[model samples]
Target: MDIIKGVPLTSYILLCSILFAIGALGVLYRRNALVIFMCIELMLNAVNLLMVAFSRYFNDSNAQVFVFFIMAVAAAEVSVGLAILMMVYRNTKTTDIDALSKLKY
Candidate 1:
């Protein structure tokens, strides 16, 4: 909790909120699949940051463990997601969301 002791909870909340909002906005407004994927990772990282912040604030290690698991899942997700995106790009020659309406093989 040493780091938590140095910073206020409110500051952590604000930073995570901003990060999540940016991620959400990018997911909603961005047309590129890769950009949207990165934004989703941003959102996940923001959540992980909040979880660690809360864990430290409350002196509980459970949230930190959960964050670790989440990070592992996110890593797996990125590997699979990037592969799919690459396949889509190869098929369509573009990564635009609108261009991927029908994914029929």
Candidate 2:
């Protein structure tokens, strides 16, 4: 659209980079599994944004198709990941990654 045309590709790249960095930092510094999972989703969305930006700039459809696939995969990942997290929380009463060490036995 006209709005997208006004923005430069570099700006999009920079924004996505910043988002990815924040996501990475959250994933590394946060102890809660749910927060880490949300960060992972943030990272994935950054990549998706980049892909859509590039696809629009290049007037290509393949990148958009890939984005759809990525969304599908993300959806499946979220369902399975949340299910596992729920089970873990039910068993351990906590979502902290460090708390999972008790499973070492």
Candidate 3:
């Protein structure tokens, strides 16, 4: 009753690629800072998924450990990123990235 054996590695890779691409597009097309941040998280998760998939396929714990580190980094990033975004929003009163262009000074 092994689930991983049923799914090919290529399929996993393809799915990861598609997810990563969607995340990238979201970041590029969305003007809202929150949405962009979410997209970045999506991209990181996609990579994590790929890493886990490969790790499992190769029967290696190293990739799993790497995934744990990535998750930790992502958590820290979320906290710091949200804090910064909150401060920016409080000052600018807007979440639109284009509105922040005045900060070039």
Candidate 4:
């Protein structure tokens, strides 16, 4: 396979995979809601990086378009999520999701 820049395709894929795994681990292990949110962003970024790599390799623009959509969604999600988090903190004085009880009225 032809090299993309100075790096090989296999290396790029492995790096993206590692980034995704780390993000997953962070999301799974973190207790703070903000940290979890950040981890989710990390995962999304990893996916975006992978998509760009594939787009470049295939000489296609579709993947880039998909990535743009992903970025838009992520931005909207962060905005709404932070707004909700602020609301939750204002009501409860905490952002620890484990302390949340959805059944409480």
TM-score of each: 0.90, 0.93, 0.94, 0.90
User: How much is 11 displaced in model 4, in angstroms?
Assistant: 1.0
Q: Global CA lDDT of candidate 1, please?
A: 0.93
Tens digits of per-residue lDDT, candidate 1, 41-85, equal: 999999999999898888899999999999999999999999999
> Judged by lDDT relative to the true structure, which candidate is superior, 3 or 4?
3
Model 1, residue 56: displacement in angstroms? 0.6
> Candidate 2 residues 1-105, lDDT tens each?
356546789999999999999999999999999999999999999999999999989989999999999999999999999999999999999999998886698
Q: Per-residue CA lDDT of candidate 3, range 1-105, in tens?
A: 565567899998999999999999999999999999999999999999999999989999999999999999999999999999999989999999999887598
Over all chains combined, what TM-score does candidate 3 have?
Answer: 0.94
Regions more than 4 Å wrong, model 1: 4-6, 103-105
Ten contiguous residues minimizing lDDT sum, candidate 3 = 1-10
